[model samples]
Target: MDNSAQAPLQTAEDPLFIGGVGLKSRLFLGTGKLGREELIPEIVAAAGVQVITVALRRVDLSDKSGNVLSHIPVHVQLLPNTSGARTAEEAVRIARLARACGTGNWIKIEVINDSVNLLPDGYGTAKATEILAKEGFVVLPYINPDLYVARDLVNAGAAAVMPLGAPIGSNRGLRTKEMIRILIEEIDLPIIVDAGLGVPSHACEAMEMGAAACLINTAIATASDPVHMAEAFGLAVAAGRAALLAGPGRSLVAGASASSPETGKLTAFLEANAASG
Candidate 1:
């Protein structure tokens, strides 16, 4: 057996720090669009995801019957999102309600005034982040990846900033790559690339670009084989992170750099071609 083929897994490295919480998995999974609640546990395990996002409005009634919360593994951290909130005030209310569920105080502030595209309102998100952070909630605000908005979020005491790669559930991978890259360059907080990531490769691309994490939902849950897709995403994220740590090579605009040694290079092909000509 080739010893080189048996390299160790990359997840053994230091845990990702977010809002003073150390998380082992950088891939944050959203528990939405999952047809059945029973599948969440297996999906989470398959994805090796430490943080799972859930919407407040989706929770089953408090009658202790068919509650989605019961399905999630207790070990995984819950990050409840303000999906139905359209303003900062509304977002704050929903966040408070989510906290009342006895889930830890991790909140993903998503204040969307635009219903058609479902784009997060940067100002409203910052506002909610401020209110939540002061209230002792670990705030992770979803935004449009604008540098100014990110600055505002940091000032508002955001633990991390979740920037959209594209519109929510569009399955358009990295449409806002440049903006996300700008956030990564400028912001001090962890930049989590969330939403619109179509496939495993998209998550891999975001991770390779130095994103602190990738939050995905529609892509995995809607797949024909959700469990396998989850596993694929987990592996892709790990490989991309490893590649980032390995320090990828520099790019050239219009030139090729030869890999093989120039000395005693294969002249046989050239000579044969010349003879044939």
Candidate 2:
């Protein structure tokens, strides 16, 4: 094996590095087809995601009063992603272009070979990561949470792996939990749960299970109350992870639900409250 191939695996102690930028928050947000740009900042603030995903080719320089970029605050770093490209070559070209446009070193490599399903070809993902990492770009590969694929990505110099919970717009919760679990269990690198997270709980579950963070967009943007939902999700992710760190309740063998009140039940508590009123 080449000496370069002997690069050690990543560890949790080390933060996710995207070129020169280092993100503190694990939750990632994407700027996709969702609308109401006014609500975007509010939602981003509510969710407390340190890294925000932006597409390279989709950038409409024609409208450049810095309209889109201006809306985003300076504090939250931008993660330029290759969302529209079909092949690794196209994705690489777009990534480089986006890096130049945004002047950001951190790039999320998204090589979606399957346009219809929008699946990340493991081969394409690996290729992109290798090429980008070689170019000294802080590359984060958005891939399916396959254990082998994820390991390969990390080995290929990926700063992080972003595995989808479900399809991009499906709003499904952890459809690939088992795969995510495998990645979390094995890789020392940041395993970001990206896409298909519908609610805050989904994010929390991923984090609690040892995911470095999660990415969300459609679910938050489409909520009846987008801003409030973002806040709620932030709290939920924190709460779930807190529970994990604090240690969850242990299970015991039982014939029935052990959660039943020993002293009083819900009916009794309601009756007491009613009497007091």
Candidate 3:
């Protein structure tokens, strides 16, 4: 079932499930990058993403007007991410804030200690996932594609697991596809391709490779036309999935198909003589 690179696809009627929510479109969007707040609703309506990912940070409890949560539409399920946390404690604190802020009950847990480049600290991410899951939050830990780490997260009661393609903002395709494939095979949770996917093909490839969904931001928001990119990516994810279902030709050491001559076709040879116009 290898669908690495295949033809384009259009959106279908089926929906993918994320933590019991049926997403109308498998194309997941990130809310951190784009700024044309007016176009967000239109773009989301256009893109058809049921699960939208957002960052969770301090809300400055004093400033009653500091409500970042007001920007998103009510219909979409907000999956808050611990994008700026340096450790498990910080992530847990942010998760609490997110749970307080949003109406939903899920957190996309990520513990990135470094500022230069946000890389998930495996230890911190694992710890945060474990703690948050125990605390009654649907912890969706964004971590490396380590099968054992994923098993540990599942044991910790995580709702789902996210693995990166490269680093955030790198725009690189799946540099860890083999490891991710291992995770896909070994784990039972939904695998969302979280970061460094530059194009729709990347997301579609993730779906074709057996990932449940993908989280895309830099690619869509940074594009020249974000709305169109979103639509394109939506189609791409669907297309890749169709290919996965359609299946592909097997590769093996065997004789290929060989063409042969026609069996018998002399009956029509004299028909031209009878046609006297």
Candidate 4:
């Protein structure tokens, strides 16, 4: 009657509950940089992503071609982001439009004012989260890894807090590792590390640091081979999560610790040999 043996195993379908919805996959892929829109579904399938993101904007009558929506499979949940919005009201408007288009109620509030860095405006994001959450939309706000902003977003009803490891699309790997670590420790909600993850190793590092999930775009989209790259990231995320669950060892500040028994010391062996000789 071992309880451990009887316990249910954590499978791939193990749900990550966010905004009251259970998501199967921790990797949330963004539909932005695939060479062709037709490649999206295939990439997502290769990545095994259960949640995907999309942007909202006015329909382009000039192109008169297939839209990005048609490429996305119906099984995945859509997380519409307010990427172009500069204010809370603008973000809310976009969210409303996205919902109206039947894209579901999940929204990623990305209110950016810094054009140079493409950094999210924490205040504007929190403001939008408050409004959208009140309107029954599950809000996931992207912000700098600032503890105060994270706290504010949590208070504003954010389903999860998305903190940047580096500037968006920089391909930098966890530049704000310390700050993100603090957020992971202090924030009650899921800490989804979005932006600045250049490689699979970077995503793995975030997961190893106990990040609940990661939102990667350029790293996968701009790779030499995006399809295979997506697959690598998927494996990296899972490996990192497993490493986190395995509980990493503590770091040594300066000194080295012996891994094996000191009793079988080489010095002792030498002394014995000399005495025998």
RMSD of each: 9.2, 12.5, 11.2, 8.2
Worst 10 residues of 1 by lDDT: 1-10
Expressed as tens digits, the lDDT of each residue in 26-118 for candidate 1 is 788887988777888787767777788988765445664676788887777899999999999999999999999898999999999887999
**lDDT (10s digit) by residue, model 3, range 228-273:** 8988888887777778778867875354333324323455556665
Residue pairs clashing in model 3 are none
How does each model score on lDDT? 0.86, 0.76, 0.78, 0.85
- As a whole number from 0 to 100, the lDDT of residue 40 in candidate 4 is 76
| TM-score of each candidate structure, all chains considered together | 0.86, 0.80, 0.82, 0.87
Q: Best candidate per lDDT, number?
A: 1
Would you give me the overall lDDT of model 4?
A: 0.85
C-alpha positional error of residue 145 in candidate 2 after TM-score superposition, expressed in Å: 1.1
Ordered by lDDT, highest first, the candidates read 1, 4, 3, 2
Clashing pairs in 4: none
Question: In candidate 3, which residue ranges exceed 4 Å CA deviation?
Answer: 1-14, 59-68, 253-277
Better of 3 and 4 by lDDT: 4
lDDT of 2 by residue, 104-159 (tens): 77788888867677878888988988998999888989998888988889889998
* Stretch of 10 with least lDDT, candidate 4: 1-10
Against the hidden true structure, what lDDT does model 1 obtain?
0.86
Residues 1-277, candidate 4, lDDT per residue (tens digit)? 1112211112344567897776656788877776676877777667777778889877788987767889887767789999899999999999999999986899999998779989899999999999999999999999999999999988999999999989988998999999999999999999999999999999999999989999999998888788788888888888888898888898885535566555456477777789677
